[model samples]
Target: MTLAEDEALAAAPDTPDDALIRLLSHRSWQVRWNAAQNRGASDAVRLAALATGDKDLAAAVGQLGDALSSTVLEAVFEHPKRDGREQLGCIAHDRTTQERLASDPDLKVRASLAGNNEDVPEDLVRKLAADRRAEVRACVACRHALPEDLVITLASDRSALVRWWLIFTRNTREVAELLRDDPDEVVRDQARGVLGEPPD
Candidate 1:
């Protein structure tokens, strides 16, 4: 079938669920992609879309937001396919899904979860702050409104990058004295900015 015709079939509201499912495997990625994004697409179609591992199509499906069932969203988050899982971690709003992703083996996925998800549980926030990967810890350090205790812990973190973010994201005036002599020169300079001292 012609590209336009294929897309029309994929996107037609009247397209049967089974047919849409079949189109998900059509040779043209656009046809399959259109089928994936069809408003009429079913939970089954959404799950199939993630399994296809086409990053763009998976992203389009993610944009469907609340139109997507929790089961469908969970499937993508837990899918063996890694195509768009990191992006999913960044924007996931469902608490259960966010918790599941918090322990994902991929550091990028966990880091994304830490850097975004405004409603992330405080327990998870603490967990990410101490995460072995500096990148994950760095993300936690960069979040605002962190507890003062967490800020102190981050200020003492071994990774200069994590300490850098702590100073970068928080109002340094509150912790200026703590960070003023940090070993990382850039971090010290940032702390100085808060204290009105020159970067020596």
Candidate 2:
């Protein structure tokens, strides 16, 4: 093994199941991604790594193919830490958790839940599509699975920034075409540019 590989193994979680955790704090992105694809890694490690919210770390961990249990996932969402809001958002695709947090009295949690894409509850996302807060609704717009109709609606949102981001979603075709005549020159210009070809 190379010297860097040894250092990463040193950084790996030291639980009794450390071997199964497959922590991805490695020097190499490819190594981290490869580890996440390691079938031997346990669900606990995948969830824990995802909770850490590292860019490359999460890219690796979030792509893990292992099945997550409600017990492990619940612990991740309920962990009493300042980062709880961020962590819960990462895994909010969990139907039960997404639904529970959709109405969380805390606006931060509600907004946080808007960022997850996987396993997203359709109704919650639809509801958040028209959230009272522009920021929250913007988060829903950033979603990969946001409904096509919501994209069209948010294209006309009061927030220009929210309208600006709709250009990135696959659901943006109609919205982009519709925004071609928006009063905001930037939105109109971008929408016209996007109308040049179908969204990828």
Ten consecutive residues with minimal summed lDDT in candidate 2? 59-68
lDDT of predicted model 2: 0.62
Cα-based lDDT for every prediction: 0.82, 0.62
TM-score of 1: 0.78
Candidate 2 local lDDT, 47-128, one digit each (tens): 6665656545554443331244565455444544424444455564556666766776566666777865456677878887
What TM-score should be assigned to candidate 2? Answer: 0.56
Cα-based RMSD of candidate 1: 3.3
Which segments of candidate 2 are over 4 A away from where they belong?
Answer: 1-82, 105-108, 170-173, 196-200
As for candidate 2, its clashing pairs are none
- Candidate 1 lDDT, 129-185, residue by residue in tens: 889899999999878658889989999999999988888887458787889999999
What candidate 1 gets wrong by more than 4 Å, as runs, is 1-35, 62-67
Counting only residues 3 or more apart in sequence or on different chains, how many pairs clash (N, Cα, C under 3 Å) in candidate 2? 0
